[model samples]
Target: TFRVVGHFNTGKALVKATCGRTFNSESDAQTFLDACASAGHVVSSIETKPSTKKPAAPFTTSTLQQEASRKLSFSVSRTMGVAQRLYEAGRITYMRTDSTNLSDVALKAAEKEISKTFGAAYAFTRTYASKSKGAQEAHEAIRPTDLSASSIDASREEQRLYDLIYKRTLASQMADAKLDKTVAKISVSGRDEEFVARGEVITFEGFLKLYLEGTDDEDGQDETTKDMLPAMTEGQPMTRQTVVATQRFSKHPPRYTEASLVKRLEELGIGRPSTYASTIDVMQKRGYVVKEDRDGTPRDYRVLTLSGTAVQAETATENAGQERGKLFPTDIGLVVNDFLLEHFQNILDYNFTADVEGEFDVIARGQLDWRAMLKRFYAPFKETVDTTMEHAERASGERILGVHPESGAQILCRIGRYGPMAQIGGPDDEEKQYASLLPGQSIETLTLEEALDLFKLPRTLGEMEGKKVTAAIGRFGPYVRYDGKFVSLKADEGDDPYTVTLERAVELIKAKIEADAKALIKVFEEDETVRVLNGRYGPYIKAGKLNAKIPKEEKPDDLTWERVQELIEEAKNRPKRGRRKKS
Candidate 1:
């Protein structure tokens, strides 16, 4: 069976298109291709079925964070912080919780509010057993302290969070949304393949009147996305409106957002809801992970379009692998992870952290002997650490790339003093070259080709001001060197040292020169060391590297050499910023 892509159209109005309904093969699909999507296919069958969508469970700590992240664009810590403020103001219940169970009074309040606001039919009081057995924090799910007012008069963030909690709590006690789903099976003129068109009509709003759960995967199509099918008989002929098959690629596992990361930890029992925020925060603080919005690279993919019994192939580009507010592992994170996995695989196992967490919980409840639990884990863990320290070689996360094509020097990618970098030739070699790995390029994933590409830098863009202008990657990052002065290549300007054109490099060079010219006001021709410059605050005097502030009352040009020296001495002797002079 082959999954072919196309659309179904009646011509009156655009109804639907899909990557749905598999055809027998490519040849069968091409037998009756429609370029304008005007080909005819008989409606073989139509079926409508009733479906009910249950309201999502009331907000647990993790669920709340996940939803807030998706709906309000709040980070996990931000969500927690806002919820905490709401709780403190007595607008909502405690922010931290694992239970989905609503208190008896809270449930009654939700029931009353749902009945009054949405009518008696919508009020279907329901109870949810907490999915997590080891529930932490408050027993009740996070909810509005008073359900009568779904929204509160507060700061925007707090109000938004409270509204969410209120709606979730109220919706949890409401009836399921009723839907009528219709599927039309169309028969191709010359093939056994069946063309399918789907439509869904929401018959009753129910809990949907208040809230719909936010999804982590935003690209996924939902049942609510389809419209009502056009009135048609089983034997009626239908014209295809739009049918284009854009290639779809399999996606890698998504990087974790703070909320999703919390959910995962909850699922694995690795950490409590209270610690989830701190756990994510600590990784970033330790430089193990970065929470950033990365503008993903663009790539081209093939497109197959069927127009009037003919297929047209073309290429289209898309921003691929784009991520927003996601946690990405740094180069050091990978290196450290690799080292830990090799030296202490047992301790690094996911189950180990979860089991220890459970053990701690047991100790807190006085069910397990705390000392006994620690002794069991500590003995083996300590032995492994000691043994590994003594016997294991240092882990640099080094990868020996193939020899350079021309020089035949062995290339290697590894963590150096500054950070992860590619190196050519070892210590014994007469000469060596090194280049720092580009941002988002990890030592573990750096390919030999990519590593070699790094060495292509230090490129000569052309001569400027009688000096050769060259761009190269350095310890700090990519920069351009000209006339004994270096200018960093700004990432925001989309400058890549390796691929920067001579024109762009010259533009940057000129911009830097213009900025320096504006900054330097005057030079002491006699001393050659002292100069008047416009610093960040205002005009200042510079003698070598030392800076002395030029008082507003005294003009810099009016100051004599002795006065300038006296001022410089005064600046040097004055109490350093953030320091104190002895009384």
Candidate 2:
């Protein structure tokens, strides 16, 4: 059944309003409703104030990387690569920078562009101070060398990034966006309960005409607050519609994305603008972190509403904790981190890295001796490293989960040679079971049930072609093994070896069969192992343990038995790389 709380009207279409706050309990909301009904609600206070939003500073290196990631879905390295290309092509200024200050010539160009394009009224010359102290990196922020070229002759990513840099450069010199913000407070006469409504009206477009916050446009505006409140005086009586209190829990601090990690590192002064992408890349390469996209889990929440002294409570579900290209630490990363924290406590501190950076800067300016700095850092660092090497136990990052219900064996998760995995027995136990952890599961968060699920793989899905089809996790990842061939599960499709249905497995098997059929060129009567096949780099001969490449001069289809044997022998006798021929 449904009930009408109240009707919402589209007012002047100039602002957006948030009506009520989430209540701690349903009774608290009910009590507020009783007060509203008994006291009667009225506009107790109202204020319309002039507000002006200043245009943001021009693109700095870190800002460029962040905005590109958020707006264009480009990774930090990809953004840097594209920016480097733009820089080499002489399309933009230096890609690497930590400053927000613009050059006089660039500032003049920006002002001229703003004046000619958006009128002289919109032009406002200004300089921005950088957040970083002693920031003289390349002197100017990242911007287009040619302001006239709104779009660059480059790839789609390059053009999009160019447009962002261009608009930001122009907007930095443009006028502030003017707005009139109206806020109203509704009071209950019987009690001290009140509700607040906020509305905003754009008095002047200013820089917003070209670029809004976080987004740039040559023409129309991005979506903004357009539901302006109706005219109401302080003494004017207001009708009670409804009071809603949603049950919301405090969220954990969000995990860092590649861009956010760079930002955080910058805040700590850990790395230079040029090093952020490389550092993050190294972390991923060394198995310290992984970037992944994940679907959020559904969480049930409650809502309590009061309309004219009637209170009702209901539960609802919402997808929560969805992650896209977010970086998460691996088990090994955590273990290594713990080891470093335990043994090299002072060195692992982020401030230590930042202070090292500061020392580098001081040395660069000739204010400090480089040799002294090295001696100071290396002596203590070397001593700690040697001490740890000799005394510290190897960090396997092992965590003991509960015992197995059936075998009474201990269940433990740790970093395995292949990756993170779960074990069914202790180190002293002779007989034990081991299963590779699924790509999505982690040692830190894996539960007993999830760990048990890992062992459930290699399960027979069903029979196909009179043979059993089973799904399992291999060193390469999850796969569906059918008959003698293996069809790997698709990561992008979110296929799980554990949950893959027989029908899906059969479909994958057929697809693999069809693909193999297309790849086969010709079979040889000379030998069963020797056959012609089409591969990624064109046609090649598969002979037993070795592959012989077909020369461009000889057509694969026209190759004779004698030529095939000669090619195979040539491939076999060819000296392997790094081996010297005997004199």
User: What does candidate 1's lDDT look like per residue over 300-374, in tens digits?
Assistant: 866566755667767789999888888998887888898999988988898988888878888988999988998
> Lowest-scoring 10 consecutive residues by lDDT in candidate 2?
1-10
Which residue pairs clash in candidate 2? 13-226, 14-226, 15-226, 15-227, 39-190
After TM-score superposition, the amount by which residue 25's alpha carbon in candidate 2 deviates from its true location, in angstroms, is 2.2
C-alpha positional error of residue 72 in candidate 2 after TM-score superposition, expressed in Å = 1.9
Model 2 off-target regions past 4 Å?
Answer: 1-22, 215-227, 460-470, 482-484, 489-514, 522-531, 541-549, 558-583
| Model 1 alpha-carbon miss at residue 236, Å | 3.6
Q: How well is each residue in 1-583 modelled by candidate 2, as lDDT tens digits?
A: 1211222222332222234444466566556655555566567789999988898889888888888887888899999999999999998889789989888999988888888888999999998888864355655798889887777678888899899889988998899889888887766676654667777789888899897555322233443554567877787766555655666666687889877887788888888888989999999999898899889999997766666667777898998888778898888889889988899889878888888888888888899999988997899889888988999888888889899999889999988888889999998999988898876678888889888888887889989879999999987899999878999899799788868999999999999999988998888787866889999999999887799989998889998888999999999999888957799
State the TM-score for model 1: 0.78
Task: Please give the TM-score that candidate 2 achieves against the real structure.
Answer: 0.86
Q: Report the Cα RMSD per candidate.
A: 6.0, 5.2
